[model samples]
Target: MTLEGALIRSEGLSIRHGGREVLRDVSFAIEAGEIVTVVGPNGSGKSTLLKALIGALPPAAGRVTRRAGLRLGYVPQGLRLDPSMPMTVGRFLNLPKRVAEEGRTRALAEAGAQGLEDRPLTALSGGQFQRVLLARALLDRPELLILDEPTTGLDQPGQAAFYQRLEDVRNSLGCAVLMVSHELHVVMSASDRVLCVNGHICCEGRPEVVAQAEEYRALFGTGTGGALALYRHEHSHRHDETCELDHTHGEDT
Candidate 1:
């Protein structure tokens, strides 16, 4: 099942919660084999867009088109672990089903949760639980993966490794990924396209180009005078080069 054309499209989409318009007229498309990341600060409607995409929330207005027969694997913003649910990691992987021995092992290993197979889901720390959920996402071998804030509550190394694992899964499954993330530096290189959302798409483009936009500055707080610093350095370098050349010629004359 190839999704070469647009697999997901939103046109004039809007959502209102508690009489507050969280998203308005947001339009975007995600294609097959492409990784499109939604980036913005908290309360910026990033998660709202994800919920709308996954059919958890209906758009108050507009259209969302998902390609027919496309399977979606979603990891929501947080995994609510229940201490009372005495399910082991392995059981969680095969949740609501009888586990096939081989399938259970493969999923755990792929998620880097092999050693955690017998541990209860509630016993796992934040990072462990994140990996467990990721393992579950892989079970169906979805055509598209939607991850909302995948790295939340993870340490730096775990976050980096999680992305690396995602890259591996994307390659292995040959599925597209749509992720909501604030860790720009991590996803910038991995993403095929970037969607910057703040109420609506402030901008969407290649990572490097989007990184330079004013909207990106407002979104990432990274372009905060960095472009000016770069320009200043370039200006200083040219000035120094001209001075050196002039001084050399004067000495020769």
Candidate 2:
């Protein structure tokens, strides 16, 4: 909330696409070494916010500021590699920038995809491919890791496993994480803070608080209320990692 040493901050940000405003007056700050999840229904500008944060999209108004000399790594919601391209995992990791073999192997191992270097990119299953993408992001040892729905196609168990692996990565690297996810059940349990968005931030707080907020319930309905209840019961026993002080701040409109 203080914005001191924030890794990235958006101040009254707005975005436009195709002559229509997608987001308006949205603002938040991601601090160092915290996990923040953005949740919204489809077309709520969740992904748009991510692109703007990463500088892939220009803001129509307001500003996105990053700490000086920030190192950022991004894992997109989906990547379409041409099936015709004959690329191996090792080669893929070295794209645009070449990494030493040792670094590549270590990153892959950390992403839970060890020994996948020589395998063709086409040969990997959906889960393995996601892990490889995570490996690529880790190559730079980023100070801020951004993921846009990195667990799209995985099943429930697989999604949990992937998030667990992500938690491990964040712990070991000591990097802040900003992710956009639709999985309320998983994100509520995993995140340090959760922001609910509907073209603008509706509510934000520690997951439990947001889950109970009228804004969140109005958007997601009582169906997910059960998930939040389940999360409260299981979360204490699950994530043993310590979180930084809760820094959730936003107007609950």
Candidate 3:
């Protein structure tokens, strides 16, 4: 079921890695200005799904589609810089091409690393580095921003802060965001929708509802049932404008 104004969607998607099926029969769509998070246990094909959406992987079956000429920005999981080579944030953003000063500054400010242009990339803390990567991803003014486990090694507080900043960026840019993470608090509070995966999409729905799902509990354990309290955010308005149907459904991804 392809959505009328979907920014990106997958239909009966199946994928393989090294002769083994990693994802199967997955289907979902993300509309403009939506924040969708993909969560699952380790080796559950969370990252593989993201790769498939962004056209990095070929499907063994099914299809993935994007809006024609869609502008995309990607921040891969745990991007590391060689410490031996020194590079400033400003210099780094100019790589392969130069970005206008106004645009670069805006991207940096949106990511909450406003004065980091002069800082060495290697000198940044884990949180700061993630912000820089986010800033770089935002430089192209993407209509859909994709991330894979962007908060790999941040502390609890750092992870929370990054997700908050991500929300702010989404609002400012009015761009759809699709990210893969194990952050359950984000599933409950930050994301407009959630997809829980294990080989395939086990379940998907609204944050609080999915958090309490039996399938989610089975994969993540009951310990995460209470993680919803870690970050609490309420919506004054409903998501009907962007969500065609209630995502609190136990249907497809």
Q: Write the per-residue lDDT of candidate 3 for residues 1-253, one digit (tens) a residue.
A: 3398999999999999998999989999999888888876667798999989888899999999999988898898887788888999999888768999998999999999899999999899888889999999999999999988887898655665677678778888899999887653345255677776767776566665465766555544554324332222333333332232322321232
Q: Estimate each model's TM-score.
A: 0.77, 0.82, 0.79
lDDT of each candidate versus the true structure: 0.72, 0.79, 0.77
Q: How far does residue 182 in candidate 3 sit from its true spot (Å)?
A: 1.6
Each candidate: RMSD: 12.5, 9.3, 8.7
- Candidate 3 lDDT for residue 189: 52
**Judged by TM-score relative to the true structure, which candidate is superior, 1 or 3?**
3
Evaluated at residue 241, the lDDT of candidate 1 is 46
Q: For candidate 2, lDDT tens digit of each residue in 1-253? A: 6799899999999999999998989989998988888876667789999999999889999999999999998999888789889999999999879999989998999999999999999999999999999999999999999999998998755776787788889889999999888654337345788876667776566655465666556544654433331112212222212111111211222
> Predictions ranked by TM-score, top down?
2, 3, 1
Compared with the true structure, the alpha-carbon lDDT of candidate 1 equals 0.72
The model with the greatest TM-score is 2
Give the winner by lDDT: 2 or 3.
Answer: 2
* Model 1 misplaced regions, further than 4 Å: 1-4, 97-99, 184-188, 209-253
Clashes of each: 0, 0, 0
